[model samples]
Target: MNATATAAPKAKANATAPARGRPVLGRFPLPLRVLGYALVVGVGLVYLLPFALQLVTGFKTDPDAAAHPLGLVPTTPTTAAYQRLFGLSQAGDGVPFLRWLGNSTLVAVLVTAGRVLFDSMAGYALARLRFRGRSLLFGFVVGVMAVPGVALLIPKFLVLNSFGLFDTYTGMILPLMVDAAGIFIMKQFFESIPREVEEAARVDGAGVIRTFWSVVLPMARPALITLTILSFQGSWNEFTHFLVATQSGQYETLTTGLARFVSGGLGGGTQYPLKLAAALLATLPVAALFFCFQRYFVQGANSGAVKE
Candidate 1:
C-alpha cells in the first residue's frame, strides 16, 4: 500500500515535468515571467497604437483630430469624413471618391488576373518545358528582378509614349501585369511539384497544356492563393507606377487620390479626419484578403521550406 502510494506521486511528477530543451514558463522565476509578459504587451501596444489612432481620428472632427493626435477618444466625434468619402454629404468637396475606388478595383483586378495567367505560364515553361535557351530566359528573369523599379520609370514612360498607351488603362496595367518576382515565385513552386505526377498525366495521353491546367494547377491551390493575395495587395497599394502612368485627373486611383487629398486638397485645412478616414478605407480590402487567405499563405511558406 505504501509502495503503491509512493509510485503514484512519482508518476505524477514525471507527467508534470517539462520536455527536454523546452522551458516551462511556470518554472521561470516569477519576476522574469512578469517582465517577459510586460515586454510582449508593450511591443504589441506600440505596434497597434498607430492603427488605433487612425481609427479614432477618423471619427473625430478635423480640429479635434489635429488637437488630440494621439488620443484614443475623440473629443467631438463626427462622420463628416466618411460622408464626404461616400458622397452622402459634402458634394461640393469634389473628391470623386467612388471613381477613385472603381479605378483602383478595376486596375488591381486586371493586373492580378494578368499576373496569374502570364506568370504561371512563364513559370511552368521555365520549370517543366525543355526549350532552347530555357536557362538563358530564366537567368534573364532573375536579372530583371534585381533591377530597381525606380530606375525603369523613364524607360517605361518612353515605351508607353511611343506605343500610344500613355495615360491609358492599358499603360497603367500592362506595365505591372508580368512581374519577375511573381514569375520566380511560380517557377519555384512549380519546380517543387513532383515530376512523377506530370509523367502520369502524360501516360494518360494528356498534353502539356491540359496536364498543367487540369492536374498541376489544381494541386497548386496554396501557392496560387499566396500569389493571388500578393498580386491583389501589390496592385491595390501601388502608387508610384500609377503616378507616372497617367496624368489625367480621370485616371486617379485611390492611392494617388488619397495622396492628393492628404496634401492640402479638400478645402486645405489639413483635413485630418478626411485623410484618416480615407486611409482606413483604403487599408480594409488588403487586410480582409490577408485575414481570409492567411492559412493558404502559411501552407505555401511551409511547403517552400521542404527540401528537394
Candidate 2:
C-alpha cells in the first residue's frame, strides 16, 4: 500500500506520453504549417487593426479625423492635441490633465499595496491556521467574488457615506483594496506549497507571521508577482468604483477624467487625437508590466490544473 501510494504519481506522469511514438507537433506537414501560419497572421491582423486605427487617428486634426475615420494615414499629423493636454497650446476652459494623472498613480499604488498585503494575510490564515469559522469565512469570500461589481455601486456609496470616507482618496481606493478574487488566488497558491517548508521554519523557532513573511512568502514569488500585476491593472483601469466613490472633479483619476474629457462635453466636436494620447499614456505602464512579467502570467494560466 505504501509503495503503491508513492508510485501512483510517477505512474501517471509516465502514462501521459507514449514510450515509442513520433512527436505530435512533428506530424504537422508542410501544407499544414502554411495553413497554420495564414490562420495565425489573420488573427494577429484582426487584433492589431483597431490599435492601428487608434494610433493613426490620434495624429489627425479634428476636421481630418471626422472626414476620414477609416484612413490609415492622418491628413495632418499635428502635435496640437498633446501640446494642449500639456498646457502649452492654450486650455479652452482649463482641463487639469496633470492632476488627473497624479490622482490615478496615487490610487493605483495604494490599492495594489493594500490588496497584496491584506489578501495574503487573509489567505495565509485560511490555508494554514487553525481557527473557528474558517470554512464559513471562506464561503463568504467565495460568495463575495460571485457578486457582480456593478451591483455594489449603490451599496458601496452608502457604506462609504456612512463611514464619512466619501469623495476622499480613502473612499476612492479603500473599497477596491480588499478584492475577493485576490484573496482566493493567494489561498490556492499557499495551499499548493509543500508542508515541510513551513514545518522546518517553525521547528527553527519561527512564529506563524515570521514563517509567512520570511520563509513562505519568498517561496511564493511567482504567485505574489502574478497577484501584483493583476491588482495593479484592475485598479488602474477601474471606472465604475471611482464613479460611485467620488462626486467631485478634483478626485478624478485617469479613467474617470478621460471618460468625461472624451465623451462630447469638453469643447469642440471629436478631439480623437487628444483622447487617444491620454489613453495611450494611461495604458503604457500596465502594458509594460504585462509584457515584463509574462512568465508569471503564464504560470497563473496553468495553475488551476496543478495538484500538490
Candidate 3:
C-alpha cells in the first residue's frame, strides 16, 4: 500500500514537472524580458514619431511649422491647410485636390480589378495548365519580376507615345494593371490548392473556364483579397510611371500631384502645412485597407508555406 501511494505521487509530480519545465525552456529572465519590451516600445515610437510630427505640423501655420518642425503640438492650430485642400478657401483657384483624388481612386480601382482577374488567370494557367513551352513562359514571368521597374520607364514612355496612349487614363492604368509579382503570388497560392478539388469539378462536366471561375476562384478568396490590397496600394502610390506616362495636369494622380505641389509646383515658399495635410490624407485609404484585411493577408502569405 505504501509503495503504490508513493508511485502515484511520483507519476503526478512527473506529469506536473513537464508543464513547469515548458515555461522555463525558452523563457528569459524577468529583468531581460522587461528590457526587451522597453526596447520594442522605443523602436515603435521611433517609427511613429515622424507620422505624428506630420499630423501635428499640418495644423500649424507656415511660420510655426518652420519654427517647430518636430513639435507634437502646434502653438497655433489652424484648419487653413484642410480648407485649402477641400477648396473651402475663398480663393477660387485653389489646388486641384479633388481632381487628383478622383484620378487616383478611378485608376486604383481599375488597376486592382484588372490585376485580380488577369494575374489570377495567368497564375492559374502557369500552375495547372500543361502545354509546350509552359515552363519557359513561367520562367519569363519570373524573370520579368527581377527586372528593375525604373529601367522600363523610358521604354514604357516610348511605347505609350507610339501608341497614342500617353496623357490618357488608359496610359496611367494600363501599364500597372498586371504585375509579375502578383502573378507569382497567385501562382504559388493556386499550386497549394488540392488537385482533387479541381478533378471533382471536371467530373461534374465543368470545362476549364467554368471550373476555374466557379470552383477555384471562390476558394482563392484570401489570395484575391491580398492581391486586391497590394494592387490598389501600388497603383494609388505610383508616381514614376504616372510621371512618364502622362504630360497633362488632367492625368495627375495623388502621387504625381502631391509631388509637384510639394516641389514648388504652386510656386510657393515652403507650404509645409498644405503638403503634410495632403500626404496624410493620401495615406489613409491604404492604411484602412491593410488593417481591414490583415487576417486574410497573413493567411494568404502563408498559404504555400507547408504542404499536407
Candidate 4:
C-alpha cells in the first residue's frame, strides 16, 4: 500500500514537470529562431537599403551620383539639389519650389479638415441617426466610390469652370473636401461600436450633437487618426485631379510642378536626383504621421477586415 501510494505521487510529480532539459528549447528551437530573425532582418534591409542609397545619392554631385548610382557613400556631397529646389543656387530658370510647397500645404490642410468634419458628420448620421433618404444617400455614396476617378476628370472640370472655381485653391480643394470612401469608413467604424455607450449619453439627457462631440468622438480616436492620416496623405499626393483642375503654374502643387519638371521633354532624360528629392520631401509628412500612428492602422480599417 505504501509503495503504491509513493509511486502515485511520483507519477503525478512527473506529469507536472517541464518537458525540456535545455532551458531555452522549451520556447523554440535555436536554428528556427535564428532563421526567423534572419528572414525578418533580410526583408527589412531589402526595403530600407534603397532609401538609404537614395538619401546619400541626393547629397552627391550630379556627375558623381550618376557614375555611382548604387553607392551609399558619396565622394562629393553637395547641397546643389536642395539649393535648386529652394531656388537658392543659380540653376537657370529656377523653380518656384517654395510657392509650390506652400500651395500644396494649403490645399492639403483644407481638404483634410473638410473631409474629417464632413465625413464624420455623414458617418454619424448614417450609422445611428435615422431620417428620410438616409439609405438612399448611403447607397449613392457607395456608387460614387465605384465610379473610376479617371472618368470624372472632364465632367468635374466642366462643373468647376462653370462655377469659375477653376485654377483656384477652392476648385482644387472643394472637389476633394468630402470623400465618399472616408464617409463610408467612418460609418462602418461608428456602427461597429456598441450602442450601449451612446444610450448612456442619451439617458443622461445629452443632445445628439453634444453626445457625438464629447462622448462618441473621444471614443473614436483610433478611427479619427486613421481617417486624418489618410485624408492628409491623399490630398498631399493628389495629382490627376489637380492636373485637370488647374491651368496656371502659379497654382501648381509639388505633384504638378514636379511632373512638368521631370517630364518636360518627350524623350525623358531622367533627372533622378531632382525628381527623387522632391518625392522624398513630399513623402516626409505622411511618413512621419504613419510611423507615429501605425498601431491604429494595424487593425486594418476596412469594414470586413476587422472582426469586432
Candidate 5:
C-alpha cells in the first residue's frame, strides 16, 4: 500500500513536468554542429563566388578574362572598360551609354511613382469602399497577376502600334506603371489595418479621399516601401517589355544597349571586362536600395501574418 501510494505521487509529478523543447544547435554533438556550420559556409561561398568572379573579371583585360574564365584575380587590371562606358575613351564606339542610362533612369522613376500612386488608390478602394462589382474587380486583378507577362508581349506590341505609342517613352512607362501584383499587395496590407481607424476618421468628417490620403497612407509606410522597391527593381531591369515596345536605337535602355554591345552591334569581340563592368554598375542601385530598406521589407513581409 505504501509502495502504491509512493508510485501514484511519482506519476503525478511526471505528469506535471514541463515538456522538453527541441534541441538547439549548441546542444547537438560537436561533430554534427561542425557539419552544420560547414554546410552553411559552403552554401554562402557558392553564392559569393560568382559575385567575386564578376568583380575580378571587370578589372581584367579581355584576353585575361578569356584565358582565365573562372579566375577571381585579374592578371592585368585595367579601367578601360569603365572609361569606355563613361565616354572618356572610344568616343566613336556608338554604344550611347549615357543615353541608355538616362532612359533607364527616367522610365524607372516614372514607373515607380505611378505604381505607388495608382496601385495604392486601387488597393484602398477595393479594401475599404463599398462599391458595385468590388469582388469581381478584385478577382480580375488576381487573374491579371496569374497571366504570364511573356504571353502579353505580342498583344502589348499591337496595342502600342495601334495607339502610335510605339518606340516612345510613353509606351515603355505606361505599360509598366501599374502592376497587378502591386495592387494585390497593397489591398492585402490595407485590409489588415483596423477598420475602427477609418471609422474614427469618418466620424471627424473626413471624406474618403481625405481619410485615405491623410490618415491611412501614413500608416502604410511598410507596404509602400515594399511596393516602391519592387517597382523600381522591376522597371529598372525590364528588358522584354522594352524590346517589344521600342524598335529605335534612340529608345534603347540599359538592357537593350547592353545586349547589343555584347552581340557585337558596336564591333567588340567577347569583351567580358566591359560586359561585367556594365553589369556591376547596373546592379549597384538595386543592391543599395535593398540594404538601406531591408528592415521595412521584412516588416512588410510579416504584416499579413497578424490580423489586427
Candidate 6:
C-alpha cells in the first residue's frame, strides 16, 4: 500500500511536469519571447520619438529647426529658445510668459485644493451617511461623468456670463472645483473602508464630524494624493474652458497662452524652437509630479477595486 501511494504521487507529478514545461498562451517559446520584447520596445520608441524631437528642436535655431524638422541632432545647439522663454532675451519683449506661468500656477493650486476638500467631503457623505435620495444623487454623479464636457461649454459660458463671473479668476477656478470623476473615485475608496473602524471611533466619543476629520480622512491619503495630482494636471492643461471663460490676455494660463504663441499671437515667424521650449517647460511640472507620486497614484486607483 505504501509503494502504491508513492507511485500514485509520482504519476501526478509526472503528468503536471509536462504541462508546466509546455508553452501556454502567454508563455511563448524563447524565440517568440524575444520577438515580443522587440515589438514592445519598437512601439515604445515610436511613442517617445515625438518628445525626443521636441526636445532636440527646442535647442535648434529657427533656420535649423525649419531645415531639419525631423532631426534628432541639432545643427547648432543653443539656449536662445529657453532664454527667450525666461525673458532673458530682448527678442522676448512682447511675450508675457511670466504672466502666463503665474496664472497657471495660481489656478492649478486653488483648483486642486478645492477639489481635494470638496470632493472628499462629498464622497464621504455619499459613502457613509444614510440620507434621503442618496442613490439618486450618486446616480446623478455617474450621469455627469458620462456627459461629454464639450457639450456643456455653451451652457457653462452662459452661466458664467449670467453670474458676472466671466473674465475672472473665480469663474476659472470655481467651475472646476468639483469634478465628477474625483467624487466617484473618493466615494468608491471610502466605501472600501470597514464600518467597524468608524464604529470604534464613535465608541471613543467621536462625533460624525470628528470621526470623519480625524479618523477616516487620515486613512484616505492615497485617494487624496491621486485627486490632487489629477486636479492640478487638469487645471494646468485646461485651455478650451479658459478660452471661453475669459477674453482678457491677463487671464491666459500656460495652455491658452501657448496656443496663442503657436498661432502667431506672440511671435511673428514659426518660432518653432521658442514654441517647443515653452511647451517643454509647461509639461515638466506635471511629469515631475506624476513621477514623484506614481506609487500613490497607482495604489489609489486600485484601492476601491475590492472590498472585504
lDDT of 4: 0.84
Candidate 4: how large is its RMSD? 5.3
After best superposition, candidate 1 residue 29: deviation in angstroms? 4.3
* Each prediction's number of clashing residue pairs: 0, 0, 0, 0, 0, 0
Instruction: State candidate 2's TM-score.
Output: 0.89
Give the winner by lDDT: 6
- Residues 138-182 of candidate 2: C-alpha lDDT, one tens digit per residue: 999999989998899899999999999999998988888898998
Candidates sorted by lDDT, best first = 6, 3, 5, 1, 2, 4
Q: Pick the candidate with the highest TM-score.
A: 3
Candidate 3's residue-wise lDDT over 100-158, tens digit each? 99999999999999999999999999999999999999999999989998999999999
Clashing pairs in 4: none
Q: Residue 142 of model 5: what lDDT? A: 97
- TM per model? 0.90, 0.89, 0.91, 0.86, 0.90, 0.89
Give the per-residue lDDT digits (tens) of candidate 4, residues 117-138: 9999999999999999999999
| lDDT tens digits, residue span 125-234, model 5 | 99989989999999999999899989999999999999999999899999898999999999999999999999999999999999999999999999999999999999
Query: Which pairs clash (backbone N, Cα, C closer than 3 Å) in model 2?
Result: none
Model 5: runs farther than 4 Å from truth?
1-24, 90-94
Candidate 2, run of 10 with poorest lDDT: 17-26
* RMSD (CA, Å), each prediction: 4.3, 5.4, 3.6, 5.3, 5.4, 3.7
lDDT of 6 by residue, 1-308 (tens): 99998999999999999788875535777898888889889999999998999899999999999999999999989988888777788754646788999999999999999999999999999999999999999999999999998999999999999999999999999999999999999999999999999999999999999999999999999999999999999999998899889999999999999998888887488899989888988999999999999999999888967666
| 61-170: candidate 1 lDDT, tens digit per residue | 98888788988999978888888888878556646889999999999999999998898888899999999999999999999989998998888888999999999999
Worst 10 residues of 4 by lDDT: 298-307
Superposed Cα deviation of residue 257, candidate 2 (Å): 1.0
On TM-score, the stronger of 1 and 4 is: 1
The list of candidate 1 runs beyond 4 A from truth reads: 1-30
